[model samples]
Target: MADAQRRIAELLARCDLEEAQHRLGELVFDAARQAMPRNLPELAQLAGLRKVPEMFPGATPTARIQAAIDTLSLAGGGTLVLDGRILEVTDTIQLRAGVTIDGGWGGFRAAPGFRGESVVAMRRRRIDYDAAGYARATNLLNLVIDCNRQSGVGGLCHGNAQKDRVDGLRIRNCLADGWVVDGGYELFGQNFEVIAASRRDGGVAPAPGRRGLVVAASDCHFADGVLQHFPIGLHAPGAHNHFARLHAWSTYYAADPPLLIGFLDEGEGNTFMACSADSPRLADNAAPPGRENGGYGFRSGGNAINQRLIACTVQLSQYGDAASLPPPRTIIPVHCGQVRATILGLEVRDYGSAGFGPFVTTPSPAVMRETTILGGNVHEGLPTNLQLPWSEPGRFLPRLCIAGSDAGIVQARQFGAVTRIGGLAVFELSLCLGGLRAGRGAVTIQGLPDAAAAPDEGHRIGFQPVLSHWKGGEPVVAVLHGGGRELHLLRQSTGAPVTGADLTETTAISVAGQYFTDMPGDA
Candidate 1:
């Protein structure tokens, strides 16, 4: 028996000394007809799979899970399959390079409202990148990481600065967040839900500046995700990232000072496609005193440049009784602040009182220029004096070409020429008309500046009729009223008021002019 044991020991030691010891222990248990310990070391040798439950049997779940991870990592990196058990952790779980934790979705409880089968109930703990080491190819799959009102799993590339190029990271269905990606490249995340737990201090207001998913890294792609209950849902301070089919919902009533935006883009060269953001509801139909209370669906910060939104939607809801609510202050669907963007098929809807237009810009030191809205709908709850595609005087200039006809809004089919001189916007506007009666046609021209006064009695600007493709005589003169907000075609060649008989379904008109705008620049 001694010789047999020595041979077994020498043979096992040839593989690995520590592994040999675990094997020997298992052999002894098997020989004694007793069940072998189902510890991590033994199970790893037996099943070639590292599991959390097979760690130190008497240790806490956190320690056991960490031990299992460490053991798998020490074996040159592998997957740590989590058992369908709730592991309560009080400390952050540090992930090493090349390690993947896959808590199979099927392993967790399937009852409604169940977070997941493999749940990591974090009592202020999080799963983060290893501090002492650089992690590459680390992933979390099908795991529910509950923050319990503390921090959630993320910051994978934290403390490494932006110099490290951590790659091949993937997170799926983690149901975790406060997730910060400060440094990383090529991350592919899908179907992940980020929920900012309620504040522990029992305060109704959101923790000051609390954000759900803060991405400060570049070249990452996220899709089909939901970020809810955060002051700012998806704050992208990174560049060259793509977010597709993501929904951002903010319920925090307290204003976050300058703005409470669902999706705030301070990054450059990012593309949001088919994404939607639901603005936050006002608290008790009232905002804090001396503070503006309202939500913005999407905001492009002053530093944001070259951003693109394709077929995205933003909706602002009016909570409680609209009549009782204070005068709507800053409720805007999309606010473009000193940035260059190209928006296509963007739908902005407001369900509250009259507020800012669908797409608007406030006065800023830096100019908001080169913004192009290709196609979209701005559906407002109430008739507002603020014009569609509105911009404040002085530095807001956006080129808008609204295609397709909607009943209430002006749809400009195309723009012939748009140029700005000093603070004045000079352009030739064109509209395709199916049917027009020339007695007195009020045409809504896209890409026009807002009027300082009400549309009822606005500054009228004269425009020369460039050309028209109507069978009847074209209007010899055109007048743009309300600071170019409304265009009225008048005076036929025969000096007669052009009647509906002069126009046909295929008629098209073009007008050229330059108007003095309230914008500050060389007039």
Candidate 2:
């Protein structure tokens, strides 16, 4: 094509007008012949290619792009290729199934400025659901949607029968929310960056956008994304979704509601692996009425069950001039509510003031049960590592009960060693009584920690005797009554202290029970 055009230009320059005109006609005919398919197979491949600028010349860029999209959709799904032009979209561009819009994104020249090839400067509208309320198997690749404070991408309605799914959706730079999925299923999104509008404008004021990515669907998979400057970077209230290598960060400036959270997870069976929630540049700001000023790295609540966070990190960067600024509010790294969860290899760091700990569990009437923190490190500088409502009386205490082994007894020799359940401490004890003799109608077990004692002297710690080789007259039940290192055992059935006469010299008894102690666990 270039050679033909160059030859025509040379011919016209040499004052050969007739020959130049004939050569232009021949070039046009050859171009038309190549566009027209020679065979059925060639026709099928050519039919799927629709270039926006070439197909709808003289039309507005938005109209041209939408016409190409509609034309490809009408042809039973095809690729709508943009000519690397910036399209100003003032109305919602409805997407259809089996159509892939390839907006030849040539990288952001000035990122967050929304300047680049194949960019859609959405004025106030969004690329949302079609008239049927869902668009399935629709893909978007190498596109940049400058939402201009409006929505970037929205999907299926709440009660839609068909699932709205986008496979292989890639946005290099998004000015607002990257996408919002409602009632979507099995959607795959990757390699996107969503930045808040305020950050893009270099403003200290709050960004009008709420979340970078909002997932209200199930079985969706998102990976390798950067979400920055949104109040909540990822608000996933969907179940069975997997997010990997996604990093969410807040800007230095504060928002109206305060730059609060990184990831707000209220979904069941959601897994976040190798993700990070960081507050690297949080400026001074007053929190909400009753809430704390600082933000949370990741918060899980609202009846969420079976959520797993594997090898995730939550960090708060240290301020350089700490004395100049007011102390940071309670910034909880990971806050889990009354839900069943497993946190493995979670790294939490706070280089600033000591606010809250790395792990915090809320005290509710429905206590958090079946929670496990396998291996994690809460670095120094925090006030306390594991903060739980341990003083909430019976409501929250017994929920973190520590059960014993196959014999239902944690050996008393391992008493000082902390046993954690959901990062809270619950100590179990099993004392072997063999050579110890009963004196003054009571057998005092020595070497027991003071935490093994009852809360008060009047409160007796109950115990059941596991008799292995009882000669005769072995006490079946007993209670420890003390507040010191010595645990004095008294027969519970008789309300009298166990005497040596009741037990033969060859008798063996193992006292086993669990107790709630004030000692904190290594969470």
Candidate 3:
């Protein structure tokens, strides 16, 4: 009721009351016809469309739609084309086996090549087909799945417990995700696919375990879209899957890592094109990754097994004392794998403990691939390095951290100890900032060179700061490298893991802060 009232108010505020009332009348009339058979005959009277087709001269499109639904309910395998501007189901209607539902494309308004409508406004869908039935549809635009009054769980899109395939659809702005996967014990779908889709701005997270496009199978593709504030965006647990050209941000925790593939699988061909990682914390907690403050980029702690990550980008926002984390310090606790990573055109800065090296890997053995750490930035902490109490053979490619203000390029060893680094390159001395403080937590980067000779040494990299501070004295020339990239900033004491609540709080603060300035997660 609140939502309806809100929409009504929005219309009234944006449009003339007379026009709003007319649209509302049409919606009510459409709803009546679908729920009441006696009302079906009157659908034509309300819409002014003839009941008889000019050729058939017998029944209208509205009648045909009803006839199809009714006949299919009996004949079993029929296609229903619904043309009324509004089709509301006040009651539950089970669509039996091999049925197809065809709704208006409004001239491809809700699809690609045409940006007609992004929102699908329709009424409830208790429309049941056998959980194991096979059904298909295309172009479900501005269809509202209002279950607020009908079912306790109000959602925009709903499906059967078993196998179902929905393709070439665009569903936007509803009570929830454009398409929803219902929760039931039944194990459905031997194979299901949703290709070329888009979902944007819906209500807040739909309960505890839901997402923009939630699936539980072996094959699913959620390609292309601008999804925001969707709690669990693009969540799929089935293995042997592929995710390409998918962009997501401001989601509490996206693409549940291990579940997307398997705990022991590889993520080689997957590409997270220009995605942003923001604070996930919503409230306060004492744990490092708690909801205590509710600001976070991701909560990918599940399957930390053998997984290969390639061609992905991550950008994080920081605040307060944590604003000075070092390079590589920002990307930490990497699991075990013969992972081939290339860090081209990357930026890491602003946090207390910038980077923590090679987190504890799984018992399974893994190798480091040709990791190119070039054209990047780092801040605050030491060239943080950390090695597993039990691990070996750490390697990289095009090994380099550019020199610049707020770019901390530390030797891998200083952060932690590792068996070996394949290619090491420090283009120039990056300008780094501060380190962690007391009570938060602490990290230690060991094995980096304390000092080096010109050109070859860590200090002689390039772009020495006009001023710097080490212990209580004057600043010195923090040597830069060959290329004018990377910053050699002051290091601080290591801090503990961040608490979840703190993250949330920080993120909220940042968001609120952005409204006053520039939005934080715009890209």
lDDT of 2 by residue, 1-523 (tens): 5565577667756767656545533443222111111223222332333321233234433444455455445545566544343455545555655566565662112223322222332111123445674554566666555544433332111222123333333442333445577664777778777665553345343344357778887888889888776667788888889999999875444332234577778888899999998763233334421122335777777656788889998776644344222245456666666467777787767756554332445544244345666555535543333334332432221110111101111111111222544323333444222122222233444434335434544445455655544433445554434443334545556666554445443334454445555455344
Badly placed stretches (over 4 Å) of model 1 are 1-59, 105-135, 151-177, 198-205, 252-259, 280-294, 318-330, 351-356, 360-369, 378-407, 411-473, 476-489, 492-523
Model 2 TM-score is 0.57
Please provide TM-scores, in order, for all candidate models, with all chains considered together. Answer: 0.61, 0.57, 0.41
In candidate 1, which residue pairs clash?
40-54, 108-117, 109-117, 394-519
Q: What's each prediction's clash count? A: 4, 1, 101
Error of 3 at 476 (Å): 20
lDDT of 1 by residue, 1-523 (tens): 3443455446554755555445533333222211222334443442333332233334544555555555545544556655434444545565555456665541221122332222322111123334555444555666555544332233222322322222222222222345666655666777776655443345233354656677787888888888766657788888888999988775324322112567888888889999998754333345532112445677777467888889998766554334433355446666665457777787766665454343444334233336666666535343221122322343222221212112233232333444567656566655444322233233334445443234433333456665466555544665555345555555645544333445554456677766655555444
TM-score, candidate number 1: 0.61
Model 3 scores worst on lDDT over the 10 consecutive residues at: 508-517
Local distance difference test, candidate 1: 0.51
User: What order do candidates take by lDDT, descending?
Assistant: 1, 2, 3
Q: Judged by lDDT against the true structure, how good is candidate 2? A: 0.50
Per-residue lDDT, model 1, residue 41, is 45
Which scores greater on TM-score, model 2 or model 3? 2
